[model samples]
Target: MPWKELRPMSQKLEFVEKAIVPGANVSALCRDFGISRQTAHKWLRRYRDQGYLGLVEKSRRPASSPLATAEDVVVSIIELRSKHASWGPQKIAGVLARRLGPEAPSPTTVARVLRRLGKVKRRRPAARIWSVDGRPRIEVKASNDLWTIDFKGWWRALNGDKCEPLTVRDAFSRRVLAVALVPATTAAHVRRVLELLFRKHGLPSAIQSDNGSPFICSRSRGGLTVLSAWLVSLGIRIVRSRPGHPQDNGGHERMHRDLSELQLSPARSRRAQQRQCDRWMLDFNHVRPHDALGGKTPAELYRNSTRRSLSPLLPTYPPEWLTRRANKAGYVRINGDQVFVATALARQLIGLRQESELRWSARFFDVDLGMIEILPIDHAYLGGTVMETVTTVRPSERARERIPVSA
Candidate 1:
């Protein structure tokens, strides 16, 4: 018979029966059985002591595993993993130790228990090298000093309606201020959500966002849309992450990852999704432990901003800056010379400050609207001079390195 087909119990039984025979040649029996002399002696001893049952296979497991994780600790780890399925062993261990004292299992123990329970999922290493840019770093002095906002990619709800979520997080404390599901990505919807957040949590010193609709306009002046211009008017500094550089707002992106994991499946309706998002925001701020925050929840570090929100009003510039109103065509007329300012600023007051004898800088409120230069109307009898803004539009570079907003 092939060695692969041999059964350990059957082989041991045959060997023990033959060895028990009187005057049996044990060495020849060992050679026929293809087993070592030590193995033959062990089976013979077991058979003499406990008979046929002793010749059967025996357990190789140790009698006691002193270093193994305790049953209660393993159960606790699995329970925590069930709550925060995305959290790894280190975070789970940290939380358990903080709550259950030093007797809690180590991170490695927790990992082993998770593996035994089939709760671990291995992820392949990304082929793309992780890179970060180091520019436009903003200092955070206190809570509400900086806030990062973005839209999680939209998905269809069970009702076949598209649900787009807008998330706003405090950069300093990693507090999630808002997570609202809206029907569209329009400025009005975003503005309403921000206004609610501002009234509740107060206004942040600065708001950071990517160059996208409602936040920026490439064709508009300073890439400022109406919503952004309103923010500038509210005395809030606007900071835009470089185009195509998501790491510029790394903290916000990380939060989006967590949110994506929570939203693995969409809800049936807009109301249901909003309710679910609200509950997640609560748990994220109050319960979830952040590894970067030294195992502290965001609510522990976050505080209400002292810089309270006020009714937004038009901005006023210094008296030296000449004030001119943009006409129906969004043009500022200087001695009958029409210069295009910005279409968004139509019928709005614009401040003009002469940078030089031939050049002038136009601004709406405090936002700059580029420079205009004077050129004489050639071969005209009236000799009226023409003033026009110089335009040199170039595609924005998207590969620029951006420093992490939180780090």
Candidate 2:
């Protein structure tokens, strides 16, 4: 009893034909065809106007959009995007706002326009949660609270020369402090570069790095490499990302990703590549606006640290704490017995505080190495008190037993 859905045009034509005939009652026809009088009249009017084509469904969209982005503004956005293809909508919006004070479109509008023009690629959503197995998160409140250092993965130049640049960034301001194409990735080379940075930017309270060469040694006590040990001697805390997990230092990795995106192709030579990296670092620090920093460039928020780099000296300990100087082989004579500490701690003074009758806590500067347990000598000829084993216990683990948890 309902109007035909598959052939609505045919039904409309039929109704119009019948209604056009003399004395055809439109209201009676509307009742018989189960259509409202208004719909019947509308179809008849459409047929009268354009013979039958006018009865076809037309677009419901308005003929004109007055509130849409102006053509000139869209052209400017496209031009800016063409200039900096890697910039996202948020960054583009920031530029547009600076260029066109009150007339700039919002980031959402820019995203929509870019998506419509096939300029934006959809990215897979990343996981929001990341856990680092009981490690306390370092809170960065100021510019020099933490610094992240890493070597950008090696890529070959057009001439087949390797191009690996060491990158260091301030964690709080996201300012890139250094990007140098070192001769090698050895500890000495990295130490030289860091010394230059320290003298220039002063010193950060802590430096973060991944578990890699020149940064950490898996076999060493506390995973301290020579470079990190030098940093520790300068009174800087060394923070390492979890082994095999790059997300522990996600911000630093994200910066590397941006760098990689910008330098898709290698330069002509290593020197040229170094120059390119230097340019990128300059732009990243001064020009590129960061969304996390509320659309401010890293250079705007960064400040040089007040802690100047000084000559490395032996750390003084409490009068009650016993101290031992590590020999060249990283062995310390404790109660007439030789115990091996880390070679990274070689030629450095270590402080020991007795925690129990047989156990003592070892520390290099402020860093706690672990607890040392003294064992009695089996034979009478050997020394009576012998330091047998050094077991590594994290400060967190030691405090977890005594510290009460709040509900």
Candidate 3:
């Protein structure tokens, strides 16, 4: 279908002689070459104008036109950069193109002109503090895959009760789920906050907490405290940061910094602190545009993403779990004896579940109890098929003695 497929010199000369000569007919020549009459005449005119030289090839390239950046615009850009040199190309582009007008040169072109003029600063890049690189930095695309939970590093208040502000936020949405001022951030308190979160937003797929005593107990024989064990019981995976590594839970850590800077720094009293924190969370979740969410509130991204909800009270199962009622002190009462599993799993009957290789775990209601491993199965992780047998073990005499004798 292309013109070049035909014999080149033969077709060219044929057109040149028959169609281009003084007495040639354009129509007859076009028919011979199997080309349109317009095409034949075009070649004929070119040949007639320039003779054989017209048949030769030339470059079919376009010429470039220099875009002149106006003096006034250039002056303004220079002035702005002089004032705030930290402003980058995109920021400048946004101001000039969107706010100013179409007359301004593109950001890249502006940058080039500035660079040529030696107006841009030569900043020696900030010294890179070496860090552990194996902890792969990643962005969570959705809510509940990870929640960063940490107590804002402790500080003494004027009263000196030692305010340890605990916080939890969705890694993806940055939704601040809880911010509480607790007298002490014990495993029990951590469990309570988690219970509130689970009851409200449903359980997350996993939680990321630091490897400290409450979040993690290195001293615990299982390397996990009762709080972590409670999480395992709920089938929620728990991830911990490297020892003494602050960046491991960077999202929550950053959130704590922001909270400390913008929210907590102003409060004078614990009551005021809690009240202001509540207000700040409302704004943070619904109003403030998150950079991560592209200036949208965290609430805009986080949704109800649970397979099921926690019932009003932990659901009861068939009489397979050794029935122990939780007393006011949050200890299980069994055979008039008590053994505290963990505060989080309190007030519920626990059944030992059987897993592969003769392992077992304790469960309350349908939730896995996250506590240190009970022998025969690691309690921190429940890898077992559901069993339906009533647990028959009574609390040992020593455990019964440990329980507070109450009215």
**Candidate that would win on lDDT:** 2
Q: Give the alpha-carbon lDDT of every model.
A: 0.77, 0.81, 0.64
Question: How far in Å is the alpha carbon of 318 misplaced in model 2?
Answer: 3.1
Candidate ranking under lDDT, highest first, comes to 2, 1, 3
TM agreement with the true structure for every prediction: 0.58, 0.60, 0.44
What tens-digit string does per-residue lDDT give for candidate 2 at 217-302?
76566677778888988889888788777887899999998889535888989999988998999999999999999999999999
Checking candidate 3 for backbone clashes, the offending pairs are: 229-370, 229-371, 230-370, 233-368, 233-369, 234-368, 320-389, 320-390, 373-379
- lDDT by residue (8-33, candidate 3, tens digit) is 76677766776646777777767767
Q: Judge candidate 3 against the unseen true structure and give its global Cα lDDT, from 0 to 1.
A: 0.64
Q: How accurate is candidate 1 locally (lDDT)?
A: 0.77
lDDT of 2 at 167: 91
Score candidate 2 by lDDT. Answer: 0.81
Model 1 per-residue lDDT at 37: 92
Candidate with more favorable, higher lDDT: 1 or 3 = 1
Sort by TM-score, best first: 2, 1, 3
Residue range with the least summed lDDT across 10 consecutive positions in model 3: 392-401
